[model samples]
Target: MKATPITLLVCALGGEGGGVLTEWLVEAARLAGFPAQATSIPGVAQRTGATTYYIELFPVLQSQLCGRQPVFSLSPVPGALDALVSSELLETARQIGNGMTSPERTRVLTSSARLLTTQERMQMSDGRRDPAELLKLVRAFSREHQVFDMNAVARECGTVVSAVLLGAIAGSGLFPIERRFYEEAVRGGVPHEKANASAQASLRGFAKAFEIVSQRQTQADFVSQVLKAQAMDSRLRGNDAGADGNDGRATALSVIPAEAGIHGFPPPVREFASLGYVRLADYQGRSYADLYTRRLRQVLDAETAADPQAANGHAITRETARWLALWMAFDDIVRVADLKSRASRHDRVLREVKAGEDDLVKVFDHFKPGVPEFAALLPSSLAQKLVAWDRRRIAAGKEPWAMPLKIGTHTAAGMLALRTLAAMKALRPRGSRFAFEQKMIERWLDGVVQGTKRGWALGHEVAHCGRLIKGYGATNERGKDNLLHVLDHLAVLPETEAATHAIAEARAAALADDAGQALDATLVRHGAPKREPKPQPIRFMRRPVPRESMDERRA
Candidate 1:
C-alpha cells in the first residue's frame, strides 16, 4: 500500500481550545503508530485574527522512525489536505480562501455560527451571512461537508462547544488513531472521572459519525499509489540522465544568438524589447514596467473607490449599512451603551468599517444630536443619578454616550435645547403652558424640517424631544407611589401613547400637591383617571381564657 499524508486543518478562535484539540490529534496519531506533527499559528487580532492549527500524520514503519519535529508550514500543493475542521463558520470560510481543501479529497466538519466576529455582528458591509447559508455553500462545494450546532450540543453534554466540535472531527474516521487517544488528551488536567466521561462521549460520538465516510479510503489509497509511482519514476529518470556520456549532453546544448545582427544588443534583450520591454537608461529612466505598474495602481484605486466592498476588503453592502445605522439608533434611544461598545469591540468590526471601529454606524449613533437632546432635559439630580449609573456601565466595559459628552458639539446643542424647553415649561403658568408648548414645538419642528433636508429625520428629532419631556416629568414625580413604574412602562409606548402618559403623569403629580384646589378644577377639565382610595390594614383580637383558670384555682 502506498503511504499518503493525512493533513487536518483545525480552525477556531484564539480562546476556543484549539491547542487542546491539536494535542489530542497528535496523541491519537502516536497511539496509532503513525508519524504526526502538529503546529499552530496563534491569532493576534491582526493577521486573519483567528487561531489556526495544522496537523499532518502518515504511517511510520517503526517507533524509531518517528521524529519530534512539528509541521509548521502549510502544504504548497492543492488537493493535499484530507480534512478541514472549524469551530466557527467564518474561520472555515477563511480556510477556503487559503486553498486548503478540494471537493474530491477533503472532508469538512464545522460548527454553525455561535461565535461571531465583531465585524460580522455589527460592521460588515454585506452584514453577517447566516450560518445555515454558509454551511449550505460549503456543502455545495463538497459532499463530505457537515455542519452542526456544536454550541447547542455542548450545552446538552454539559461541556464547551470546542470539545464537542473536536469530538465530531475525530469521529470522522479520517485519522488512524483509536478513540482512546483523543479521550486521554481531553482528560489532561481535568478531574479524572469527569474527563474520562467527556472523552468517552466524544470518542463514541466521533466513531458513530466516522463510519459514514470510512468507505472512501480505497479511492484515496489508489490516488496515493499513483503519485508515489510518478515520484519514483521521476527520480529514476534523473539518475539515468546523470550517467549519460559527454557527447549525449553536448548534443542537448542550444546555440546563442549573436549581438551584431540584433540591434547592437543581445538576442534575448532584442526579443524582449520587441515584445514590449524598454531599456530604462535608453528610455530616460522610464520603461514599460513602470508604466504598467502605475496603470495597475490606478485601476486598483478606481476599483476600490467604486466598490464599497473592495474599499473595505470584504463583503459590506448598502443594506448592511442601513441595518447597522438602525441598530445604532435603537441603542441611542434605549441608552444602551454596553451594546454600542460591544458592537465594535474587535478587529473584525474595524476591518468591516475600514475607517476603524469608532467610525462604525453603531458607534457613530451616540454622537448624533438627537441622542443627547433627550439626555439633556433630564433633571440635574436625575442626570447625576444617571452619571453614576453610567460610571458603573463604563466600568463594565460600556461606552456611556452615543457620543462623547463634550461641550459645544451637536450633542450638546440638543441637550441645551431640551434643558431650555424644560426650564420654559417650569416657569410658565398652568393655563398659559399650551402657548409655551406651541412655541417650543414650533422651534423643534423648525429644526426637524431644516435637518431633514440634511439627511436627518423627524423620528430621531421627535424621539429626542419626547425622551427629554418624559424624563423630566418622571424625575419630578419619582416620590409618588407607582408613578415611576407607570412611567417605566410608558417610556416604551408608542410615540402618541408616550406623549399622553407624560401629560397624565405631570397632571397627577400637580394635582396631588396643589394647595388651592386648582388641580381639581384642571382634572375636571382634562378628564384624567381618578385616584383610588388607599386600603387600610385589618386588625385582629385574642381571647382571655387564662383569667378563668385563676378564678377556678382560687375557688
Candidate 2:
C-alpha cells in the first residue's frame, strides 16, 4: 500500500452531474474498503464557472491500516493532483491555468467538445477560441492526457455525460479501485422507480467510454514502439532525422482525402474545393456543385498563372472555394425548413430531451417570417415591388406583414408543411435573392481573379472579404453591403501592396464592428469614401398628456 492518498479533482458544468459523479467515486472507494473523502466548491449560475469536486482516497485499504485512520485533505494542493478530469475543453484549460496541474504528476482526461463561453458568443464574428490551443496547453501541462468527444458518446448511449466520465476515469487506471466497484456504485446510485432502464443506459455509456479509452492507450503504446524501432534503425544507419522527420511523417498522414467533382483541380485547391462541391451538392444538386467546381477552377487557373512557382500554395483559390460554397448555400426560409425537417434533427432533439424508447415525446417548432423572407422567393420584378411596399408601410408607421406559425412537428400536418417548404429547393434558382446572390458572387469571383493576376497578397485579401457575407436578414444584408463597399473602393485595378494591406485592414474592421462603422473608418483612413448610409424616413409621434394635468388645465 502507498503511504499517501490519491488526490483527484473534477471540473464539470451545471446539469452535467458533477455532484453525482463525485458521490459515485466516493461510494466506490468506500465499497473497495478504502477511506475516502470529498469536498465541492460550487460555481455561480450560468457559465460564470464550473462546479469543482476534490477527492482524496487512502491508497491503503482499511484492513491493512491495522486500526490506524489515514488523514485526507479537504481540497487539492496545486501540483499534487494525481488525476484531473473535465467535461469541457475550455474548462480543462482554465483549471490548468490556475496551477492545479503539473507536467510531472497530473494525468488529464478531458472532452474535446465545446460549450461556447459568453465572451465567445458575444463576438460579432466567429469568436471561438481555437481548440488546438487549448489541447496544446493540456499536453504541455499534464504528464499524460486523453481527449475525446464525451458529449457525442453520452448522446449515443442515451445517458448523461457523468456516466461516460466515470467510465473514462475507471479505464484511465489512475486509481486502485476496480471497474466492478464503479459499476456497483453506478447501479446503487440510480432511483428504484426507473432503475432498470436508467442503469442499462448508464452502464452502456460507461462501457463504451471504457472501451474507447483503453483502445486509445493501447494504440499510443504501439505507436511509441514503432517510432522507437524506426529511430533505432535510422541511428544504426548514421541518419539522425529527429523531430523534422517525425513532423514530415505526421504531415503526410494529415493529407486531405480527395473530394468528388474536383478531380480536375490541383491537389491543394482540390482539398477545399472538394468539400465545397459536396456541400453545394447537398444544398442544391449535382449541377449546382458542378457550377461551384467550374467557378473554383477559374480562380485556380488565374492563381496558377500568377504564381507559377506555387509560393502561396494556391491559397486564394482555396479561400474562394470555402467562402463561395458557404455564400451559395445562404440561409433562407427554405434552407431553414430543410434543416428543421431532417430526421437527424428530430433524433437530436429526442436525445437532448433524453426520451426513452417507450416514452412518447412531441416536438414543436415556431417560426415568424416577415415580409422580406417571403419576398426572397419571388421573381426579381415582383420581389422588388413587394419589398418596396413593405418599406413604405414601415415608413408610414404601420407594422410590416408577418406570418407567425406554431408547428407541432410530431403531427402529420406540421411535418407535411415543413417538408413541402423544404421541397421548394427547385424554385431557389429562379428566385430574386438567388439571382442577386449569384450576381454578387460573380462580381466577387471577378475581383479575386483580377486581384490575383495583379498580386498574390491582394487576391488573398480580396478572397478573405467573403467572411463578411454571413447570417440572414439584416445581418446578412449588412455583410453583403460591407463586402461590396470594400470591393468597389479598395479593389483597385493593378493592385498595389498598399491596397492589399488596406483590403486586409478593411476586412478586419468589417468583422470587428457589425454596424460597419469601423469598416467605414478603415476605408476613409485608406483614402476612400465611407460607405453611404441608406436614408430612413422620419415619423412624428404625439406624446400622451397625463389625465391629472389635463384636468388641472381644464379647471
Estimated TM-score for each candidate: 0.38, 0.92
Instruction: State the lDDT of candidate 2 residue by residue for 415-444, as single tens digits.
Output: 999999999989999899899999999999
RMSD of each: 27.4, 3.5
Question: Candidate 2, which ten residues in sequence have the lowest lDDT sum?
Answer: 243-252
lDDT of 1 at 132: 66
Residue pairs in candidate 1 whose N, alpha carbon or C atoms collide under 3 angstroms:
119-349, 125-316, 125-317, 126-316, 126-317, 171-206, 366-402, 366-403, 367-402
On TM-score, the candidate that comes out on top is 2
Relative to the unseen true structure, what is the C-alpha lDDT of residue 151 in candidate 1, on a scale of 0 to 100?
56
Error of 1 at 473 (Å): 19
